[model samples]
Structures are given as C-alpha cells and as structure tokens.
Target chain A: MTGLKLFSRRILPQLVTLAVVVGLISIMFPGFFEISIANGRLYGSPIDILNRGAPVALLAIGMTLVIATGGIDLSVGAVMAICGAMAAWGITEGYGLGLTLLMALAAGLACGLWNGLLVAVLGIQPIVATLILMVAGRGIAQLITEGAILTFNHEGLIFFGSGSLFTIPTPIIIAIVTGALVTLIVRRSALGMLIEAIGINLRASTLAGVNTRVLLIAVYMASGLCAALAGVIAAADIRGADANNAGLWLELDAILAVVIGGTSLLGGRFSLIASLIGALIIQAVNTGILLSGFPPEFNLIIKAGIILIILVLQSPTIRTMVIFLSPAPVSQADTEKQAVNQ
Target chain B: MISKKALVGAGLLASMLMMSSSALAQTVGFSQIGSESGWRAAETTLTLQQAKERGIDLKFADAQQKQENQIKALRSFIAQGVDAILIAPVVATGWDSVLEEAKEAEIPVILLDRMVDSSDDLYLTAVGSDLVHEGSVAGQWLVDELGGKDCNVVELQGTTGSSPAIDRKNGFEQAIEGHANIKLIRSQTGDFTRTKGKEVMESFLKAEDGGKNICALYAHNDDMAVGAIQAIKEAGLKPGEDILVVSIDAVPDIFQAMAAGEANATVELTPNMAGPAFDALAAYMKDGTMPPKFIQTESKLYTQADDPQAVYEQKKDLGY
Candidate 1:
C-alpha cells in the first residue's frame, strides 16, 4: 500500500498521460499496435515519434536541471541556431568534419559562458541575460550565413543525421545516451543537492558553503551543450544550415516538457525520467493529431489544453481535495495521541 | 545680461524668418516589418535609400514583425500629421480599423511587398510579384519535365495566414489540376525557414518507406526548398536527378544549388520591387494620381540550362 501511494505521488501523472495518449492513438489508428520486429529492430511510425522527440528531449534534459536551480534558459533555441549556422559555415569553408564539430561545440560553450557571466557575476536576471542572447544569436547566425542557406558536401556529417546503429537512428541513440548521463549526474553527484538547496533557500545555502554561482553557471553551460548537440543532429539531418528557422520556437516546447514532467518552475525538484516521458507524450500528441485527419492548426489548441490540464492536476488544492474525497479514514486515536505529543 | 538677451532675440528672429521662407517637405511615414528575412532587409534598405535620394522626409518605424507595433507606428504617424503613409503588413487580416484611421487623415497609403485585407480602398497600390504566378510557373515547369508521368511530390509551405502561402498553393493547384499523375503525398508549412523545412522533410522520409517513392518537392520559397534538398541528399538520394525540386524565389543560394546539380529549378521573385513602387508613390505624392490597384512584377523560371554564375551576378546586382 505504501509503495502504491509513493508511486502515485511520484510517477502516476506521467503514467496516466501515457495511458491517455496511447488510448487515443490506438483508437484513431487501427493498426497502431501491430509492430513487426525484424533483424533486431521494430518497424513502424513509432520510429518517427522517437526520432522527432530527440531534440526536444535533449533540450528538456537541460531545462529540467536549470528549472531545478530556480532559473530558466530562454536562449536554447537561438543557441542551437547559432551553433548550426557555425557548423554549416565551418564545413562549407572547407573545414573537415572534426574541426566543424569542435567549432560548433566551442561556440555553444562560449555562449553558455557568456550567459553565466551575466547571470552570476553581473547579477542580471537569468531570463534577461538569456533573452539578450536569444535576440542576438539569430542575428549572428544570419550574419554568418549572410542570410543564405549553406549546403555542404560532407558525408560524415550527413551520417550523423541519417545513419543508424543496429537499426536505431543516431539522433535517438544520442538522446538516450545523453539522457542517461544527465540522469546519473543529477542522481549521484553532490551538485544536485547544492542546486536543490539554492532553490529552496538561497541565503541559507550560501551560508552553508554551497557554491551557488558555479552550480548555476554549470547548469546553463550543460544546457548550451545539449542545445548544440541537438543543432548538430538537426543540421546533419538536413545536410545544410538555415539561419532563418533552425531551432525556432523550440524553447517553448522544451519548457513545456520540463513543466509537464512535474518540475516546478519555482524550483527545488526534478525528475529526469518524467521529463523524457513528457517529451515523448508531446511528440505522440503531435503524431496523433497528424494521423487523426485534423488540420495542423488544431495541434496548437490541443497542446495548450493538455498543458493546462497537467497544471490543474499539479495544484495543491486539487491534491488535497482528492485525498479528502477518498473513502478510507485516518484513525482518531492516533490523531489524538499525535496532538497530545505535540 | 543685456548683450545676452539681444543675442537670443536675434536668433529667434532669424529662425522665424527662415521658417517663413521655406516650405516643409512632405513627410512619408513607413511602418516596416522587422528584418526577419534577407528580402525584408533589402526592402527596408531600398525604401530608405530612395526616400533620401528623392528628398522625401521618410519617418521609418520597424514593427519587428508584430501587428500591434505596426498599428502603433501607424497611429503615431497619423498623429505626427505626415502627408503620406506606407506599410508592409506582417499578416493579411486585421487592418480595417487602423487603415480607416489613415483614410480619415486623408493620407495616401502605399502597400509594399505584401497586401492587407481591408476593403476600404485606403491604400493606393500594391507593388509586389504576382505570388500565384511564381508558383504556377514552378508547377508548370515540373509538369513539363515529368511529361505527365506518375510522380509523388511533397511540399514545404510558408507561414500560415500569410497571403503568399495561400496564393502560391492556390496557383500551384490550378496549374497541376489536370495533371493527375503529379500527386502531393505530403504537404506542411516549414514557416519559411531552412531548419523546419529540413525537419519536416526528415519526418516525411521516415514516414515513407525509405523515401524511394518521393518523386519531387515544391516549396513556397527557395530557402525551404534548399533545406529540402539537404534532406534529400542526407537520405542518400540525388536531389535534382532522383527527386526533381522546384520552388519560388531565385535566391542566390538556389542558383548555387542549381549550379551544383542539387536543385532543379526556381522561379524568380525579384527583391527589387522598390524601384517601381517608389515611382508610383512619387506620382501619388506629386499629382495625387491614384495608381492602379495591382502593379504586377514579372517572374521568370531558371533551370540548370541557364548559366548559374551569370544569373548569380545579375541577381547580386539587383541587391538579392
């Protein structure tokens, strides 16, 4: 009974969401469940759900960490755009794949460091600091491309986008591996505790000798790396870099996924698995909308409605009401004893 | 103190005398959509340059692609008592009330690069490419190339609620109507970005069985088509050969792509619609000559047969 209650408290929301999505998709498409597994691979449209979910999953992983520290990074999408443009520019300028990848990663790290300096040293608000980068990054991307779409003749880069290992897409593989590493870091390292402390009580944590500034910067830097990796995969898939629309409006979806995964925007807790599940749920919803014969415009309304429903479920008042509405009652003798002890 | 007062009185008298002798230049207020695309940047630069050359006092305001900001700028322009107004609307709808205000102010308005959905006839003329014609030319070229054979095509659309997206789709459908063999298996808006174009094409590739059946692609603009070409190449198929591609807007990169045999063809939508636009605006300003409602620009289709290097040079000269 205790285990069941704990699961309900910790994991039930994601599970319920998964069930609802599965039910809806299965009902709408008759053959959704019939998957053929051949040569150690599962073949179907489900592969697309996983593939499309990868970039958002990467962003959500980083966003979950930042939100746990009571901060937000609104510039991930722009960072991705800049990184993509840089990679494409590098490759087109006759640089090898290794150099291009290194440059892209370095650009992302530099952007994060810039954001960290503003937020940690200069005392700018996280949103304001990142927002400046968000506005400037796209401009920088345009400058690099000269407002032109750049195509490269690099095969190794294309492989990252289209190649598969054991029949699994490279992007999906990267997402899963990166997600595991992030999960391990947050679960096993002292950094997670420090972040939680800072979020819960900043003054007290600083007094307790927690390096709040460094942790905050690290979180943002990690977010930058994640966004950069997503950019590489995206650019690789496209085999080109487009400054105009690469990673556009992606930050919104990342934030939504993090919030839906049960991380409080106000800070203090995060669930990596839940966040991944949140990314999957959103992708599934999008695919479901496409397969349901509804026009694409309805997808926005459906996403907004789902987010609202999840937020309502997270309300403290609703949880309390649900608890009170249960048929089981607490023992009065124990309550009286507890009162006397107090 | 007496000397200082005499000097101030002399300066005021001199300014008043100068003001009385000189006529105030006609001010043309312009509300531009933000510099989101290369074409938008070029248009803004041309408008400013032409205004300066013609000695028109152009008060420019950028809306950063927001309708509210454009409306605010227009109201301010009206308040400033400008003689004329110009607007490049971000979206086609929601301009009735604001345009009515401009009409009440008796200011002649010109639409540039885009059109609004107001029935008030407040604007003098729209100067832009026939977007539908551009799309039809692309479609007609593809039809001629395919020779009415069965071909599956995918499309990358532009931003929704925009006039170009609606008109381009309509025109393409009209051209491909009787050609039943050219089938559009997948169509979605890439919002006129290279990334979304690539992303949507990626999904299309994954959904289809190895993307072997996709015969051709059509994009509302060249940027998305270029992105689609990337996707096609990444899928291990030749772009221009295995899958013929066509799009509107002969951006320089499209020419480069065509030169490299990655893209098949594109219809030209010259970004230099400014010259003729200013000509019409000048007439309206000088003599109150109401120009025709639609001033259409010519569009041409460019294929691999055309020397891309020469086309590139010509387009670069046109400030593309």
Candidate 2:
C-alpha cells in the first residue's frame, strides 16, 4: 500500500493523464494501434512523426535542463542553423566527417560560452544574453553560407539521415540515446540538485557553495551541444545545408514541449522523461492532424489548444483535483503540504 | 579690374544654372522590397545598374521586406519631390491608402515583380511574370508526362495568402480541371522554406507508405521542390524517377538537381524581371505615356533533356 502511494505521488498522475489523452486520441482514430512493425521497424505515418520529433525532442531535453536552472536559451535554433551551415561548409571543403562534426560541436560550445559569460559572469539577463546570440548567430550562419544553400557530396552524412540501425531510424536512436543520457544526468547527478537549488534561489545557492555561475554556464553549454547535434542530424537527413531554414522556429517548439511537460517557465522544477513524453505528444498531434485530412494551417490552432489544455491541467487547482481523484489520499496531502512548504 | 569681376560673376551664375539643370534631369525614387530572395536581389542589382547607365538619379530605399518601411520611404520620397516613384510591394494587400497618398502627391507609382490587391489603379503599371501561367506550364507538363493516366500528386504551397500561392494553385487547378487522371491527393503550405517543405513531404511519404503510387510532386518554387526531393529520397524512393517532380522557379539548385536527374521539370520564372521593369520605367520617364496595366515577362518550361548542365553554365554566367 505504501509503495503504491509513493508511485502515485511520483509518477501515476502524469502517466494517467497521458494515458487518458492517448486513449481519447486512439478512440477518435481507430487505426492508432494499427502501427506496422515490420522487421523491427514501425512502419506507417507514425514513423514520420517520430523522425520529425527527433530534433525538437533533443532541443527540449536541453531546454528542460536550462529551464530547470531558471535560465532560457533563446539562441538554440540559431545555434542549430550556424552549426548546420558550418558542417555543410566543412563537408563541401572536403573535411572528414569526424573533423566536421567536431567543428560543429566546437562552434556550439563557443556560442554557449559567449552566452554563458554574459548571463553568469556579467550579470546580464538570460533572455537578453541569449537574444544577442539568437540575432547574431543567424547572421553568422548566413555569412558562413554566403547567404546560399551549401550543397555537399557527403554520402556518410546522407546515411545518417536515411539509414536504419537495427531497423530503427538513426535520428530516432540518437534522440533516444540523448534523452537517456540527459535523464541520467538530471536524475542521478549532484549537478541536477545544484541546478534545482540555484533555480529555486540563486543567492541562497551561492551562499550554499553551489557554484551557481558555473552551473549556469554548464547548462547553456549543454543546450548548445544538444542544438548542434540536432543540426547535424537535420543536415544529414536533407543531404544539404540550408542556413535560412535549418532550425527556424525550433526554439518555439522546444519551449512549448518543455512547458507541456510540466516545466515551469519561471524555473526551479523539471522532468526529463515527462518532457520526452511531451515532445512525443506534440509530434503525435501533428501527425494526427496531417493523417486526418485536415489542412496544415489548422496545426497552429490545434497545437496552441493542446498547450493551453496541458498548462491548465497543470495549474494548482486542477492538480489538486487530480490528486484527490487518484484513489489514494494521505500521500497526496503530504505532497501538497510539501509543495506548500516549498 | 571691374570688367574681370563682372566676367567672374557671370561665370558663377552659369555654373549654378548647370548644377540646377543636372539635379533636375531625372530623379527616380525607387522603394525596393529588400533582399528577400535571389530574384529580388537580381532585380534590385539590375534596376540600380540600369538607372546609373541612364543617368537617372535613383533615390533608392530598401524597405527590408516590410510594407511599413516601404510606405515610410515612399512618403519621404514624396516629401523630397522626386520625378517618379517605383515600388516592389512585399504583399498584395493593404496598399490602397499609401498608394492614394502617393497619388495625391502627383507622383506616378510603378509596381514591380508583384501586384497590389486594390483595384484603384493607383500605380502606373505592374512589371512581373505571369504567375498563373507559370503554374499552368508546370501542370500542363505533368499532364503530358502522365499521358492520360491516373496519378496522385502532392502540392507544396508557398506562403499562405501570398499572391504566388493563390495564383499558382489557381492556375494549376485550372489546367488540371478536365484531366481526371491527375489528382492532388494532399496539398499543404511549405511556407516557402526548405525545412517546412521537407516536413510536409515526410508526412506525405508516411501517409502514402513510401510508394511510387504518388505520381508527381508540384511545388510553387524550386526550394520547396528541393526539399521534397530530399524527403522522397529519404523514403527510399528515387525522386525524379519514381515520383516526377515539377516546380516554378528555375533556381540554380533546381538546374543542378535536374542535371543529376533528381528533379524532372521546372518552369523558368526568370529572376531577371528587372530588365523589362527598367525598360518600362525608362519609357515612362521619357514620355509620360504609361505602359500596359500589367507587363508580363516570358516563361519557359525546362525539362531534363534540356541540358541542365549547359543551362547551369549559362546561369552561372548570368550571376544567378
């Protein structure tokens, strides 16, 4: 009984909510369970959703960490663009794949360092600091590509986009692996505790010897690297480098995913697994809309509605109701009291 | 000494008259929609070059793809009292008021590359390609290739509510009206971005189960087509072979794709819309006689057999 209560307190509410939503969608779309898994590959339209969801999922994982630290990285999409342009340029210049990937990683790290320095060291607002990079990174990308699409003859990169590893899409595998790594870092490491502490109270954490500045910088750097990885995957998928549209509006999607996963925009709380599920939900909704023969314009309206619904459900009032209805009572009250105490 | 001073004063007066006459020669105020695309860039470059060659004092303002900025520049030009005005509108709507303002100032306005929505005839003439015809050309080519066989197609639309999107779709649909063989199975806006185009195409592929049953892909522009090709290839289908791809813009990448046999056909919406545009502007400057309400540029269909390599070589020379 105690174990069940603990489980309910920790994860049951989110799982139940997710189940209810998925059940409703499945009811509406009869073929939702008819996903074809041939030779270990999930065929049908869902694969596209999973594929398209990869980069956004990667970005949301990083954004979740940064938001948990009470910071925002607005330059993630631009970093993706810059990294893609650089990778494409390098490949076109006959650089080896390993070197090009390294260059992309280094560029992302440099951008993150610049943003981190402004926010953590210089005491600038996170939004303002990242916004500068958001604007300048795009300009840098354009400069790298000379405002043109850089086409390359790299077969290895193309394979990363289209080839399957043990019947799973490479991008999907990468996203899953990255998600696991991030979850481990956040759930098992001391850094995660420090981030959460700093997010909750920056001054208190500094006095507590948490090295808040270093944590802030580290979070942004991770976000940059995640965005760069996404860029490489995207470039590999397309077999071309398009600076203009490489990562356009990805930041918005990442923010939305994090928010939907019960991460507070104001920070101090986060869920890596929940964020992954949220990203999946968003991707599924997009795929559902497309498969249902609706016009693509309706996607914006539907996505906005989903975010609103999720946020409203996460509100304290609804959360209280959800807690009361979960068939267990004492632990729910304890968690509520603990939250109130915090 | 008195005679020398009198001569000097006369010479000074002559020089001032010459300056005034030169300044008044032909000041053409041009408010350009900033560099949004390669075509727009080429148009601007050609317009400036032509203006310089003709000794027309081109008072240029780049609106940077904003209607508000263009309107502000236009008002500034009006205040400066230039001889004539040229505008390349970013959109087809919301121009009646500003155009009326220009009209009230007695400056003739000429539209370039795109048209305005209002029927006010506020502008002298619009110099652009026949956008509807460009779409029709693509549709007709697809029809010929299909040879009266049933075919499923997916369309990659341009920006929603834009003139190109509306007109191109209309033209393509009109051409394919009686042809019961060709059907557009799925149509969605790619927002004219390569990424969005690929996203939409991925969905299309998934829904269609990565099959060659999808007859052809039609795009409003080459960038979207290129994106669709990527998605098609990713789905393990040969783009130009399994699914015939057609689009409007004959961009350099499109030619390269064609040369590589990854793209099948495209209608040339020449980026050099500037040549005819300047010719019309010069005629108007020479004599206040206005040209046609819409000056249509010529468009041609480019096919794989048309020697894309040669065309690529030629376009490189043309600074594409």
Per-residue error for A253 in candidate 2, Å, reads: 1.3
Candidate 2 is scored at a TM of 0.84
C-alpha root-mean-square deviation, each candidate: 7.7, 7.2
- DockQ leader: 2
Write model 1 residue lDDT over A10-72, tens digit each, in one string: 867887887788688879776555544333444445776787789889999888888888888
lDDT, candidate 2, B1-320, per-residue tens: 57645643563465345447777567777888876656666667777777778787677777767788787778767776777788888888998888898888888888877778977478878878988899999999999999998999899899878889998999899889899989899888888877778878876776665555588999999989988887777666798999999998887788989999999999988766556766777787778667899889888999999999999877653433
DockQ for model 1?
0.19
Number of clashing residue pairs, candidate 2: 0
Q: After superposition, how far is residue A335 of candidate 2 from its true place, in Å?
A: 12
Q: Which 10 residues in a row give candidate 1 chain B its minimum summed lDDT?
A: B14-23
Lowest lDDT 10-residue stretch of candidate 2 chain B: B7-16
- Where does candidate 1 chain A have its weakest 10-residue lDDT segment? A35-44
Tens-digit lDDT track of model 2 for A1-96: 996676456554456656665675567656555555543455556577778889999999889988887889999999999988889888888888
